[model samples]
Target chain A: MKIEHPYLMFLGDAPDELAAKTAIGIKQWRPEWCVAQLSLPGCQADLGLPEMSIAEAKAAGVKTIVLGVANRGGIIGPAWMETLLAAIDAGMDIANGLHTRLSTIPELVQAANAKGVKLFDVRHFDGKLPVGNGEKRPGKRVLAVGTDCSVGKMYTALALDAEMKKRGMKSTFRATGQTGIFIAGEGISVDAVISDFISGAVETIAPANEPDHWDVVEGQGSLFHASFAGVSMGLIHGSQPDAIIVCHEPTRTHMRGLPGYKLPDLKTTMDVNLMHARLTNPDCVVAGFAINTKSLDDAAAKKLLAEVEAEFGLPCVDPVRTGVASIVDKLQEI
Target chain B: MKIEHPYLMFLGDAPDELAAKTAIGIKQWRPEWCVAQLSLPGCQADLGLPEMSIAEAKAAGVKTIVLGVANRGGIIGPAWMETLLAAIDAGMDIANGLHTRLSTIPELVQAANAKGVKLFDVRHFDGKLPVGNGEKRPGKRVLAVGTDCSVGKMYTALALDAEMKKRGMKSTFRATGQTGIFIAGEGISVDAVISDFISGAVETIAPANEPDHWDVVEGQGSLFHASFAGVSMGLIHGSQPDAIIVCHEPTRTHMRGLPGYKLPDLKTTMDVNLMHARLTNPDCVVAGFAINTKSLDDAAAKKLLAEVEAEFGLPCVDPVRTGVASIVDKLQEI
Candidate 1:
């Protein structure tokens, strides 16, 4: 059955627009699925969408509650339990993509059971994958990598893929995260994969060889994010893309959740990503930028894009506010 | 209970001395634990030790069988299952570190259960780990990294640690692989860690805070191996070592399981490792090389080591034959 409606749940405030990546992605990719967003009064980030209460969501026939924001710990905080329990009592299933599973919480489990509501932990998918043989896969493809974690890599890739499909192109959006898995209906939650199979997981999901085909593989973690940079390198090598779109949120000053560790500049991130990606495909190139200008106004974003494009010699666009036409056109041109 | 006695089992042929890593490590690290080795006549790679058959092994009163020598696919092949079943029937417990578990094999499981023998699968340990914050951990330490999979990385670290201890310095051997887990009684099994926590897993075990301590972090996978480079990168950053010992097998032409990919030379491997390690610790340096000259004769080995030392301007030694004294001494001098 088609997911005609969904209720996104963000129980607290995000530090910035970048941290609101989940809601931003849904609003851009599948706006119709979001029937309502549950946020407390005087709290929440703007994704250019309206908000709705739990009762309003039930009245509107919302089927699932999407935990749409990633917290620092990726666990359901105590402050939000009351709201989550109410959602379960309203007979709605909860779909979470955090590291901590809702099933592990006995109170949530009991409440969900009493109401006959199911719980879906989207990040629990794991399986061994064969070693990636680093050969150049046939056809034109690109991946969207980022300067930091949750910086709009998936949204950029999906937007570019959606645009290509609209023009009747043979394009595929390959997901590597739980949110992407939920959206694509099927994909490996790559973080759950064994270390030896991390690259192989990407290679399998985003395999190329079809004539005139393109695969926009999703990137996970960040090359500079000390906690999980291993996954970043795996995806970079596994995708073996002919081109790459570097994604970033302009206003973030430091690495997410990791204090004292500063974010590398755009140039450093691109250079590092290309060096690692070329560890597999020597022909890989930085094609463009999927700039998340959510933190900046239209005027500031335009100014920043001009400077970045001039310095990096690549086309830059916001997948949400500005369409990803430049990036799509650039990849096709290559 | 201490593992005072173990029966080493290498069911089939190993490609080279480098492939007999488990036996080499055991002979050096815990010789008392190895009661005997099980190998067919006219077979078995040289570990500078004698081989024993199953009948002789039983006559010697062996208690537990240690799965030595990693195979091509990490699965118990058809030819080996019969021998493994026979060992179980003879009232000996089994301990396996292969990717495929003995519990999954119905025939072996039933036989072990009937004979009241226990099975230990060492690669199944996994859990969620916090991300590495990339903070400056206290004290000085070094990690042993390699250019390819199973190229004597773990053995190098253990040898270095042992030598350091013999010199009366404070040092610890931290294992990151299944073989090391078996030897150390406990470890994170770095390959089994979730992608998001790869670095964190390394940090948790190899943490350093003492003013005069060192952590000899065992390496896994390789920087150039496309299959699991992510894990390598994560371990590099998570451990945040002051120095790194690069391990390599002169005979490994391609990656262990991934063919068509030529091995990166020492300089290239060191350059790549330093580039990634510098992402976390800019002060990190490539200390030396733990060369695996298992295929060469004694005279040929000395010549190759001298040439390698002259070229890279770093101390070079085989952990098993040369005993890692040069690497340990060089680290102390640093």
Candidate 2:
């Protein structure tokens, strides 16, 4: 739950659409954890955070330079090597949440070790998780689902957990992917797991052992997103949540990482998720909706929220702009 | 397409339910490819084929020993090593479709090489597949989807392809898993693939490039099976199928590998699958139903088929016993 020290996030060679992941993630949850944003030319204008140069970030006592945006294909380019080595020599640790491991790269590994700073590759996990056997969990499972990847599944779960703990409820935000793993410090990178063992990994992480506690689990990939659908299904089954919070990014026309694939509607999306969830636990229900209207203006977002609420008869709110109180209320009742 | 030589199958200490996979798979399609069945003491009676000792298989000119059943968790037991090594020493090539590859085991590798016999790890592959883009395939795609794993997705696709070719249609049976890979000689093991690239693998296998033809694509997992629903979704989205053959095992009470998970009914399964498929291809439709009525007696099987046809208003048949002509006819019309 602690950042330990201030961190500067470097969005080196990250495209605008992809680079927003780090800026958006920090804005919604831990704005304080990030002191500034460092981006190159084209992406600098739309980073959605206070802009700062490397010198300014260092002057602000930033301990780690987080590689925030998970680039497509998770590649760390040879062009970025000079900047990375310079940061390490400047006595700052680096945290990466890419599929490629920083530990495996000899040049980066030696540079970080020389400065006595850590290189956290959040996506890298050595432990193998077995397939989930639907073991009896000790607590209520509240899993946050979404219409597509990076639509706020983890943020919704985290936001819901933060809100619940504010009322003195014991809640656990179970991380299922790399960024969530970075935020939580420990988790099975569910996508990194072998196909057969995904559910098992989720079950192990949120084993329902904590009595009266709510395990707010993160979701990955959408039921609609063709790329990571297997990971999504595994998370749903393994977590075995009694209540589901459907997160939707309203402005997303297509699934992330999968262009030309149109997103499913809110109702279809909710029904599809619940239809599968009910397969393992028949009593499973869609408790509420966590909408991400970040792309819409405040007034237009409110209008769209009202429309969705009227259509689905569920409490809907952008968890980032407004707290997830409405969804939390529905969840507690469930 | 060429067997080249005959092969014996080894199902070592595999549980009765799982061992049936090998017995049933070979019995339906490539009975001629298999010379004899080789099992340890316990699984012998339930093999559903003519039994053979190692000596009998070799004398009968069996060219390879195929590991038929894919074990749960894909774990190859240490206890089975003696039997496998003996088979290698006896000059029998070993073919495995399990995720636990024989190529990774030193003992098996050394023994096979010494005997000059090839070891076929069907699930093992070096090439990485990308995410399936809903490309304009040249030929029509008819995917065989199912309500649960082992409900005969692969069997139905194979059966439909056979029937179509018999009727003088250009049909290609594209295998998505290991057993089908062994039978077909080449195909991607979709479940073994990374979660992100499942659809891409399917696209590569069943690309719509064959004009005036049918790609009878094999489906994996189930939309209702809590454990592998993601794989199911990926297959559906990646294939961008023009039509769907919904397969079901009439007498099964639960999904394979997921204990106590009651199978989703045919109509609901069809609706849920189509709902996701339409996210990419709006013209996608459930063409027919492939009922695996193997466990039922003749009268009961016929009665169940009649009931399914009446209920769903689709062509229903046990693709193996009765052939997939009814389903194939429905596909051609679509």
Candidate 3:
């Protein structure tokens, strides 16, 4: 089950020039592994030469071939499957980045098993590379938020982390959840809504770079696990805050209708939810942004804000208006 | 580019078993092509001999291998990919089935292209082997629906189809969208809420089994694009019936907070959405069902029914009470 000599071969929509770039990313991430991208002839889309390419890979001493297939209609089509089989015949172990239900293909699985070819499904990783030291313990103070799969929650987290750095605040982005948490530096006022959600009572506090002592918040509910919820509750109980700021996609409705919950129009519901959190934590301030508001007009946007103010009875602001530049300023003033 | 003596390999979860089954399914679907499942040595999950199996597969004159990888987190994971690569190294053509975002796997894509592996993504085949006569027609209709994917829409369609059959009605499940019109049959109904949302039409009739025809309905409002809204509308319009039966998860809420649309409590909202559809189609009798009600007591069930009747002003029945068999019987009588 262990590969003694493994070489990488790229397939399906694999850019010729980008092969080096990929090798770089992999090397950067896993420096211990001797990884190099193997090129094969007849690999171009126009040539459609599956068998010839596979032969080239085998000749190049490539023990492992990574194949890419297209994603269409929420699944992969048939063309890619034909090519993958050709490579297997050419004597190369296969790894695929095809967006199709591979479970449906039985013959391929059996063939690989018989050959002792190790297959790796790449979709689960979803741009997630392994991080942190292998020996490190799992960190605490984790937060998980529910979000639309496409929303750039990760990007927002990165921006927030940058803002924290500019303000001389020590914070770390917790990568376990859909988005990371930014721990604040000293003398930073925690938003009431955030404080309440965390159950932390703090007059003024800052985020920590390490997970050992930091406030963790996430945007998507799907990523929220019971253990994470318990950890959040523990953090909140341990440190009460003056305010809490929640970054979420307002329009996305929670699925399957949990008890005592109503599906909300993505925009208004987000505002109301944030406001409700603020109401529960009177000493906290709540802020939210409509992640999908690019197409929204001024009038529609104003109405959404008004509804939030009316429902939650709290002062609210958009993340865009405050901007990443002013995060330190706002934290300092608070 | 032609694969002269192409060896196709299937790889994934239970690679050996899946490959065997798929070879059978494919052969049955397309008898014109000679296909066989190949087994490799040491690929079995049973922890048996590895070298002997590989030798046997090669001896069988198996030219290709297909891999069936396991599905994880709504997509394929890494183990399957690794296995497929191993088979390619052992001299086999690879075909893979792994679904979920593969755009990020450049190395894998390159290897497959370079190795001339015929990769196939099978998620869109709807569990049916694709057997076509090499003919392409414009606007060909393909209908795909699942019971779980559309919140029991498939079951609802099946129930309605059964009802129609029982009535001795002559109806064909139209494959395409542009088929000639026919009178809506018994137990067919329109989904008013979905219709209103998509086409601005208060009601749109739908037939059984043709869940893909929702695009024809005009005048639906913004809610048409809500998750499963298209399927809902298609079910309504495709039926094109004199009467409509609405089946849905009882907890779901449709478009919330439109002007003059008071936000109903979760229970009330579900009921009202159904009722609204009934109101939109005055000529249709709306029968509704709440799926997955095995846990409720008689009293609780009655209360739910009462609430629906009170809110929607329609006679609604539980599918459980009118057992599936009984309903089929009634449809036969009609």
Between candidates 1 and 3, the one scoring higher on DockQ is: 1
Residue A268, model 3: Cα distance from true site in angstroms:
2.4
Q: Which ranges of candidate 3 are over 4 A from the true structure?
A: A1-155, A164-171, A174-286, A290-322, A325-334, B1-157, B167-287, B291-304, B323-334
Best-to-worst TM-score order: 2, 1, 3
Q: Write down the TM-score for model 1.
A: 0.79
- Superposed Cα deviation of residue A148, candidate 2 (Å): 3.1
Model 1 lDDT tens row, B140-219: 77988888988888878888888999999998888787778667755778887777788988888878679688888899
True contacts kept of 3: 0.00
Which of 2 and 3 is the better model by TM-score? 2
Number of backbone collisions per candidate: 0, 11, 180
**Which parts of model 2 have CA positions greater than 4 angstroms off?**
A1-95, A106-120, A124-126, A257-259, B1-24, B31-65, B69-94, B106-119, B124-126, B257-259
Q: What is the C-alpha lDDT of each candidate?
A: 0.79, 0.77, 0.34
Q: DockQ numbers for every candidate? A: 0.65, 0.43, 0.02
Each model's TM-score? Answer: 0.79, 0.80, 0.32
lDDT of 1 at B78: 77
Where is the poorest 10-residue window by lDDT in model 3 chain A? A178-187
Query: Which digits, one per residue and each the tens of the lDDT, describe model 1 over residues A1-334?
Result: 1122465555355556666676666666777777777765445567665577777788888888877677777767766787788888888888776768888999999999889887777787544578777777776668888889988898888888899999899988887887786576457878887777888888888876686898889888888888878988899989987888899987787889887777788898898888877877788899888888888888998898888889988888888888889878788777
Candidate 3 chain B least-lDDT 10 residues: B178-187
